[model samples]
Target: MSLPRIAIDAMGGDEGVRVMVEGAALARRRHDQFQFLLVGDETQIKSALESHPNMRGASEILHCEDVVGGDEQPSKALRRAKTTSMGLAVNAVKQGKAGAAVSAGNTGALMAMSKIALRTMPGIDRPALAAVMPTLEDEDVIMLDLGANTEADARNLVQFAIMGAAYSRILLGRKPRVRLLNIGTEENKGFDRLRDAAADLQAAKGLDMQFDGYVESDKINRGEVDVVVTDGFSGNIALKAIEGTARFVTDLLRSAFTSSLRSKIGFLVSRPATELLKHHLDPNNHNGAVFLGLNGVVVKSHGSANAAGVANAVEVAARLLEDDITNRIAKDLAELGEARLRETNGGAASEGTGK
Candidate 1:
């Protein structure tokens, strides 16, 4: 079979075309079967490709003179969709010219363009931004609604759970342990939407998931659950808080290690262990944030990410395409529909009997 070509917004990231092109080259080395559609300025992209001989052979440049600004509003960005590098890359996926699109540009703009161009999949009212984060255990945890939508209702929350589980299956290769993020673990702790969504998930019969009820924010990184579902507003705040805390701890450790000569000596002795911890906590290692529930795959790479980060994001897009994630989501939705139908029928029968 032919390898799926990934559309890259070469002009997107803060590091400019050079970093994006280099990252694509690195990803090509990791995934030999992948091809690239490099969308950006022809002269700049060609010049950047000169530094990456291998990428030249695997990629074709699509000239796009315009770019979406980092601070541009989604509404204004939408108006420039035809000429912007990010827009063109996403359009390639919608046009079937590429299997997936990856951008390290404005998050809001990318989300807006992707939704407008590709639309959401059947049974998905809104697409959620899902990303994997390091945990205390050896594996990573998947969390969703990371600022895709500010608020979500019961149905939206339930859909996020299903979508998150499907992504977990692809990444973990099995049914994932899913949970709703809430203030408390008790059944009646959260608001009406949380309780309603929990009930729906509990009653869902055909979903390939293990719903583990509510999971408090404090336990998110404990590796207790494989997937955590929540509203975008909450999820975004939690994600940022986790990031900030990681930075704080690392900074404090650095300060402690260099406080005195004795501490410096100790740091040298523990350098290897510290290096491993640094690698584990590096944002570059977890650079991909996917917009799930879209008709086609779209990965949002961090705007300030380096080459390694961009490569990781590209790899994520390729994996989703290879795993046929969209189809898996559709199947899960079909199962949910069947379950709902059965429940309705059962309720009607009980009503008719009037016991």
Candidate 2:
């Protein structure tokens, strides 16, 4: 068996090189089948590796000098941040030096660089970022186009569903139930584009998966869908809403507990349950996001990710590479032919021609 190669952007996250290097070491310890290529400034990476010398020879460093800030325009950085760590890590995957790429850099910059370097699969219109989130049902739900295609058309939405479904199958080991995000479950509740995509998804062929129609935002945590698809603009908004709500509720609970002696006693009694909730909702536990529909496996981690979170993200990338996810996605997209059919049928037909 060939050992998996994962390229890590060593200087991308807020925690800096030490945490990223330690994360790679942690992942290597767990999965001995992977050899990581740590990309960053050579001097810093070497210094950090010396402090934590466990993965001593299992990892290697690829040096690059510049760094792109989160606020930099993605397109501009892709063209300009040529020697940056993010570009170097992604370039490794493009150059075949690595089986997959993992990064904790600026989300937009990472997406832009991956798209530019790896491009999209033959039948894919746009690449979507698919992230798994913990649900109230003790299982994770896959959410896609999380700021990838901000203004996607109906056809793009359908493509996101297909890509997300394939990912869910490979990673989650099941045929995911597909759902479209809408204002209501009613067939005519959303905008024209969403309604059209919902219909197209219903008529999609060659996928041995389940389509569960429209899912309202309220249904996200209720286990209503295994895979929820939407354009990046709406998906990003929904993601932020969930994050903010989780933090707000946690803070509210803490304030309530400290309000009075009686509440403090009650909180002490329920400390275990509160801790469980915190553990379950922490974004670090679900740190990886796959850039679906790309030619190569690219997993993006949160900017604020810690060492443990980076380790988990690396595991996700390694698993995707091992499962031959890129090949599977190519086969699925080629077999479906929906995207091509839409283009053939006058480019804007009311009904999808899954020809």
Candidate 3:
């Protein structure tokens, strides 16, 4: 079956046209049924496509010379929604010209444009930024609200959990193991926001997820948790910390290996193991950061991502489109709505009895 065409902001990333077109070409090669609406400078896109004949045949160029800058403010970029490459790509999704949009542009700008263009899905108060992180297990872990909203109350956290669970189901193919990111796993450990969200999830029945209480930051990439939910403030901090630590380890290993001839020989002996570690930790391998809870799919690729990373982001958009992530989240929200209604009614009855 043919998949829906994905709109790519071909001029949004660091290397712009070249990397973007190459990435789309690589993705199309991987998923032969994939197609794209490549939005960018007409000349640059056409030139880049010459080397990737496969993409040339599968994509239609949407000429756009205006581009959202890496440092431009979201407010500033929002005004040019109709002319900018990133804005036009997102508009394609809103206009039904594309099933999803992918970009490596300014994230704040992308999020702002997408929210205004697509709006939040029904029952979602605010959309969350969700991304996968490398884990010890064969599968990766999904974490959300990385930097969307600085603060989220219990209601928002519950919504995030629901959205994250639906995303996990799509990506991981199982009833996800959900957890709140907290300082401690104990019930009384976190602030009211975390504890209250946990209570609601526990009290509500029939949620398609296993509410696994809480997980500490240390355990985020330990391969035990499936979905980690938290406010953007905390989530962003944890994400940066994890990224920094990974880099530190990689740099340390490189220096150690090159420090001496003995270490160099040892590195050669352990090259395979090190290569596996390098692959596992490469950000490009887990490149897509999805704006969940949107009416349509909008994936954010790392600005520095190379062709492989961009390809991963494109594939992510394709998967979400094929699986109908919005509908999946809608169904999960409906179930949660039923559960919340039951909880409210049960509470009302208890209050009336004065027991």
Candidate 4:
């Protein structure tokens, strides 16, 4: 049997090579059938490896002279930093040297580089990032497009729906209920693009997905939508706001716990529940985002993510690889295009006639 290989960006994040090496090592221990290739400055990577004897024989390093910083413009970096560590890791996926790529580098640069190297699949207008969000229910929800494409049309939203649905099915082991993110439940609401996308989604065929119509932001965690679709701009804002709110609430609770003797006693009594909540809200458990609609899997981890977080990202990549999500997504997207075209042309003659 062949082992799966993941390319790691050794020079990314604040923790750098130590976390990258540790993450790869941790993942390898669980599944000895997995291997990794760390891409970065060869000397720095080797020096990092020398500090850990356990990983000496487990991984290989690929030399790359440059590294793209987090603040660098993605478009400019794509042209100038072709040999950077992040670029090399993603390029390996395009070249078929690895099954998947995992990077904790600049999100914009990674997204741009992945698209440039791997290209989007046929019929996918623009790729988007879909991250797993913990829901009030026992499981997780998949949401997109986390700032990959800020401006989207009706067609783009429909494409996101198709891609997100396929991802839910492939990763979650069942078809998900799809919902368009909107301010209201009525079909007449939302921007013109969202309204049109709702219709397109409603009439869409061959997706084998359940469309539950428009769901408001409040319903995201209410088990009303398993897959929420929206433009990248709104989606990104929602993601950060939710994360920030979660942190704020946690901090408030910590302050309360340390306030007084009574509060400390109360905290001790609620410690178990608080700990469980922390586990559920930990970003490390769900650190990876898959750039859907691409030819291959490109998993992005938070740039400040630790070894555990990177390990979680690696697990996501491995699971997607095992699930063969891209093939199913492509099939669904192709069907959506055919359905949208038929609806448009079929309605063309009836418009403005009031018939």
Candidate 5:
């Protein structure tokens, strides 16, 4: 099959058209088969593309006169869906002109526009944002609901698990060990909804995942579980906390290394090891946060991300398109439906037989 073409919001991100276009060019180098639909002002996009000679023939520019501001409310942004650069890029996905859409624009605006344009997939109540995080283990871990829905019911939590597990399968190439994030690891711990979700996941029959009970926030990066599922409220807070902690440790190390002459020499001696650590913890390496459960793939790049980070986000979109993530999600939902049907039928039969 031919590689899918990705739609990019050229006017999005802090660096404007330059970084987005340069990122596209970088991504093209990694995946030569992929093409790009650059959506933004024609003159600016043309100027940006001029800097990357090789990207000239690989991209098609879609002129967009308007743009959604980073601070614009989702309600107001939705009204500009037909004209904004972000909106046009997402619309390309809805119209099937592009396989996926990537934007570094306003997060709220992007989410609102994507849902309105592409709609949620069947059996998914609400879409969730899933991102890969570097872990102590050899492989990165996938976490979900990073600010999509503020609150999730038991059913929503269950759906998040299924979607997360499917994503893990794509990234890890195996059935992921899924776990519900909570205050404690004990089954009896956490709120009613979390415990209830855990029970349902444990009783689930057909999913190709191992339910590993509850996992605390402290153990998330240990790589014990492949997928960590949680409501958006908690997930968003946890994500920010982890990011802050990573920054803190890195900053502390820098301070320690520059404290004195001896430390400076020590830093030079350990430069190789520190470089590896920096690479591992770099946010650019894990820049993409996918909105799973949407009918079409939509990757949200960090607003302040540089060309390398944007390229990483684009690569994520390409992977999802190639792997057909939506189809995999549908298949898993079917399994869950069948399992529920069987349970219902069995329960009715037992009641009728007075067992």
Candidate 6:
């Protein structure tokens, strides 16, 4: 069966049209059923399409010349929503011209445009930025509120957990183990919002995943937890710290290997292991970050992503569309949302949890 047509902001990435078109073509190669609405400069898109005949037959160009700058603020970018490539791609999703939108642009601008154009889904206070991060185990972890909102109440955190768990169900193909990110695993640790969110999740009946309490940042990539929920401020800081650490380790290894003749010989002996590590650590393998809880699907690709990374982002959008993720989240909300959690008292729910 054919997948939903994805709208791509072809001029949004660092390399602009060439890399975006190539990536879409690469994605179409992987899944021939995939089709696209390429939104960007008409001439540039057409020129890029010439090398990818496969894309020519499967894709259509929307011809948007205006592009959102990487440094532009969300408020400023909001004004160009009708004309900018990123805005137009998101608009295509809102207008039902495409099933999902993919962009490797200014994240704040993309988030702003998406929130305004698609709005939040019913029962969602705000949509969080969720992404797949590699873990020690084969199954990657799903983390959210990466930078969408700086603060979240207990209600929003509960909603984020629900959304993250639903996303995990899709990615993991089973009930996932969810956890709140906190300084400690103890019940009284962190603030009331953390404890309150945990309480609500524990009380909620028939949730698809297991919510066993909080997790520390050190355990995030350990593969023990499936979802890590936190406010944007904390989540974003954790994300950057993790990224910086990875870069630090890799650079350290490079410097070590080239330090002397004995080290270079050792590197040759360990080349196979290092190559495996390189592949595992490559961000291209996990390039798509989703705007969960939006009325329509929108994916954010890394601005510096190459064609392979862009292809992964496109494929991520495809998979979400195929599964009808938004409606599934809506269904989950309808069955057990704020009403169920808010109405149930803390004492009774705590007794039920036996904690």
lDDT for every model?
0.95, 0.85, 0.95, 0.85, 0.94, 0.93
Worst 10 residues of 4 by lDDT: 51-60
Can you list the residue pairs that collide in candidate 2? none
Q: Determine which window of 10 residues in candidate 5 has minimal summed lDDT.
A: 199-208
- 1-355 in candidate 2: lDDT tens per residue? 4656889988888887888888888887777767889888999999889966676677888888788877888988888656898898888998999988888888899988999899998888899999998887756899988898888888898888888888888756888899989889998798999989887777665565688888888778887688998888999999999999999999999999999999999999999999999998888889999998888989998889888899999988887887887788777777567544755465456355542
Off by over 4 Å in 3: 348-355
> What is candidate 1's TM-score against the reference?
0.98
Tens digit per residue, CA lDDT, model 5, 208-269: 89999988999889989999999999999999999999999999999999999999999999
Error of 2 at 239 (Å): 0.6
How many backbone clashes are present in model 6? Answer: 0
- Tell me the deviation in Å of residue 229 in model 6: 0.4
- Model 3 pairs whose backbones collide: none
Query: What's the alpha carbon RMSD for model 6?
Result: 2.9
Per-residue lDDT tens digits for candidate 6, residues 1-355, read: 7776999999998999999999999999999999999999999999999999999889988988899999999999999999999999999998989999999999999999999999999899999999999999988999998999999999999999989998889888898899999999999999999999999888876778799799999999999999999999999999999888888888999999999999999999999999888888888899999999999999999999999999999999999998889988887887675547555566577889996
Where in model 6 is the C-alpha error above 4 Å?
338-355
Candidate 1 lowest-lDDT run of ten: 1-10
Instruction: Score candidate 3 by lDDT.
Output: 0.95
Q: Between candidates 4 and 6, name the one with more favorable TM-score.
A: 6
Evaluation by TM-score, superior candidate among 5 and 6: 5
lDDT at position 305, candidate 4:
80
lDDT of 1 by residue, 1-355 (tens): 3567999999998998999999999998887788999999999999998888888778888999999999999999999999999999999999999999999999999999999999999899999999999999988999999999999999999999999999999999999999999999999899999999999999997799999999999999999999999999999999999999999989999999999999999999999999998999999999999999999999999999999999999999988988999999999999999999998899999999994
Once superposed on the true structure, which residue ranges of model 5 sit more than 4 Å away at CA?
Answer: 350-355
